[model samples]
Target: MLVGDGARLAEAAGDLQELGLGPMGTTQLAYLDPPYNRGGSFNGYDDNMPRHEWLAYIEERLVAARELLAETGTIWVHLDDAEAHRVRCLLDEVFGVEAFIADLTVESNPKGRQLDRFFAGSHDRLMVYARNPDKVVLDGGIAAAVNPADFPHVDSDGVNFRLLPLRNTNKRFNPMTTPTMTYPLYGDPETGAVAVDPGPGKVEILPVFGDLTPAVWRWSRDRAVERVDELVCRTVRGRSGTRIDIYQRDRHEVGRIKKLKTIWLSQEVGSTDTARAELRAAGVDGFRTPKPEALMRRIIELSTVPDDLVVDLFAGSGTTAVAARDLGRRWVVVERNPDTVRDVILPRLGLTGS
Candidate 1:
């Protein structure tokens, strides 16, 4: 649940823990995108803290965040270049090196700027850590090609070019992650084509699609068979050669193609424009420097899944709450100022405390 408090974070942590959050019962993710100690005024909330002060502030809040996180949950702290390293040192002490997932540099501004002192500071850092290193889920995979040319040979009516499987010749044991990813290799003596068991006993010739990493076959047996059938349906023998229908890669399915990266771009995540649009739709708008709904949405997507409870202490314009609701996740935003929560924030969300 979201709660805004005027007191120190340590105090709030105790209060939240007693409210039944710990271990396996409730999956709690304590996400704090606090002021970057950049001396910016967040609606009169002074964020400019001295170096030592920033470190101390992080220590207190990090302690509280750790206490509030569920055993299997995680904590994602966002910061700028100014104090990312300092914050990492404190995080390393608290969350440990093994738990550290990434030190992402997010591009805050895409358009390059004219500067003489240094390169345009287009990025920020997001320190991600799992409460329990053993169970944290990570999304990883290559970016899918959107153009049909990327796939090349269309196999079916809507299918893109299919990759012929390469025989698994060199197999290595990776104990850290997927153990079942190991297999054997096979090849055709005459055609010089490699035979691979994409999954189970399914065998197919390796495509001449240039060099591919071992075990990176185009598709598994079931998938390949489906593709073959599809290809046949759309296949037409022309005077030149066999022709195949091509289809554009579906954008929505990109998330499922592979694992997700720690570094997210403004395009991948919701942008300030999208956030403003959502707020506009909800009839909530005010606080300057409000987090773009896209930014909050990306955070929510990672830490908390649908139906999970999310809490944001510095509720500000309530972008977190709005994004959480839109994603089907329940959220609570705490703002000590009653007017911000009651009049400005809650009204926009259509929620009331009475």
Candidate 2:
């Protein structure tokens, strides 16, 4: 379904309900790329607005959006540094703080924007929130191609592997919050055997290295015990005495799927220049900023399955619609600019009318 009136998203959603589309929890994913309120002018819409007015504008639509989302649905709001914090607060109010998800930082521009004052702006923020966090389904195991040369060590089975530190690197991992990850790991100095309990040949290992600070493990005791075969322990001679270091041997297998990270680099996701080029190739003009199809494809693949309903409220150049259709997903788009909807979106989608 394509809508030429973007301002009436709530009304459009109501119309869909009448057509037996979204009766109150039917949309699986809603991807919004609304205007950033940076005083920019597009073909038929003005992005400039006062702070309070903009917040009110977004809040009303968001209220309607919340009603259209399924119990396990997710919404991604794309914005810039201009109103991210304020928008986050609004989202919290609209969707409840418990439903809030990750604030993904997308590197839309690889080359930082040149400015005479202050630092350069290079990234845009994507706020991801779910209607019900416990029930939300996310296929985070989307892998990116890696070079074999990056992993140097060859295991006994002739598989290339890399040693990853067993200690938790994130500062947010506090023992107070997660007591299970604060336990000590006993290791044998001679042999590379590790044990959670003290034994005759095992020595108690300190979480930190000579530092009084508390150390935390990435995995809990039970998890570590379950994956003991993948663990590698080595005895290292230090100034204090002999200490055992724990490592996890990560094998480099072809076509391996890994969890997607919050930071999306421009090299992995297409940049602004790539988006412009794509629009030009599709004979689309007057749309100043368009998101690349690669970015939309990645978002769709990460959050949805084939035949899932995807909604794009700010359908600029119709990149999301095209990406969803190509990926075998159903999509509904709304564009405020009638010219863009008629000349660019419909033509690109091979449709004659809105």
Candidate 3:
């Protein structure tokens, strides 16, 4: 970790460049949680900076950060309401508007700030960007977990799965929008038998709403035909007798990828309260806005995998590095406070007795 106690990123502007990091474009992820321009103070760190200076500082870091990413890599900038909008524009300017990925609203302060000028703010923004748009590779990985109990049904071959609607139920997804997805299939309502083509003792079923509004299938005919074995026909008894409904098996497998949403709020993802508790539990103190390792873990999991290089310029309490290490990733982190490095970070990383 590079030790440089300065006015946040201003006095220590060359910290990242001077570190002699890996090749220019070898890093897979860069997590930046620098001192927010809150126009106030936090502990010994002064967060009050002129608006232009603050933006310039962030712009320098962002420009330098873009150089340290691989084609498949991404960057996440953590900031509160203070500078999110301005930083968003800065990010777009630095990493082209086309590279903008997500604006993850992290529910950090679940209890919402009590005293404010107008309304309470409960979330922090995580501005994400890709070095190369076409090569953006994000995998929610193990962090995107699902309780297997939800998929309780066991298949004949001893696979756990649950039946899901095979039709695209969304109003926008219909014969009017995706005509190619509208097709006919044969099914036996009584026997739960299904086929892509006409079969004896089978009835033709079309994807439609209960009111007979034309709808589309989630899959195309060719894909549905190729994975026909994965589909099932179930008999549904509504107000009007029985009808065959096409279903798809949502199998519970070893590796399941869950799509990360825009707004994050979960115990596992953690919050500002959990972050303070984590520091206290680690026997560390003095960070006014330290992030929980779980939050960092989630971000790292979404962007990278094991052995990938993760860089953190504003390491602070070092939660990002801790999460990266625990997840089996190689990391290069910088902390401006030497005392934090010797006292809190080193001990937290198990590198020092203290």
lDDT tens digits by residue: candidate 2, 96-126: 9999989999998788888726877889999
| Per-residue C-alpha lDDT of model 1 across residues 1-354, encoded as one tens digit per residue | 444553545455566544333332354565666777877766546677777877886788787767656676777777777788888888889988888877765655555444625876556677888777887754434334134454555433654554423223333423223334433333333323333334343333322212332233334445533443222112225555543222112323333444566566767664444556666677766554456776776667766778887766567777777788999987666565666767777776777772
Models ranked on TM-score = 3, 2, 1
TM-scores, each model vs. reference: 0.68, 0.80, 0.91
Question: What is the per-residue lDDT of model 3 for residues 194-219, given as tens digits with 9 covering 90 to 100?
Answer: 78999998889888765567788998
Which candidate would rank higher by TM-score, 2 or 3?
3
lDDT of candidate 2 vs native?
0.80
Evaluated against the true structure, the overall lDDT of model 3 is: 0.81
Which model is ahead, 2 or 3, in terms of lDDT? 3
Best by lDDT: 3
Candidate 2: residue 60 Cα off by (Å): 2.3
Candidate 2 colliding pairs: none
Better of 1 and 3 by TM-score: 3
Clashing pairs in 3: none
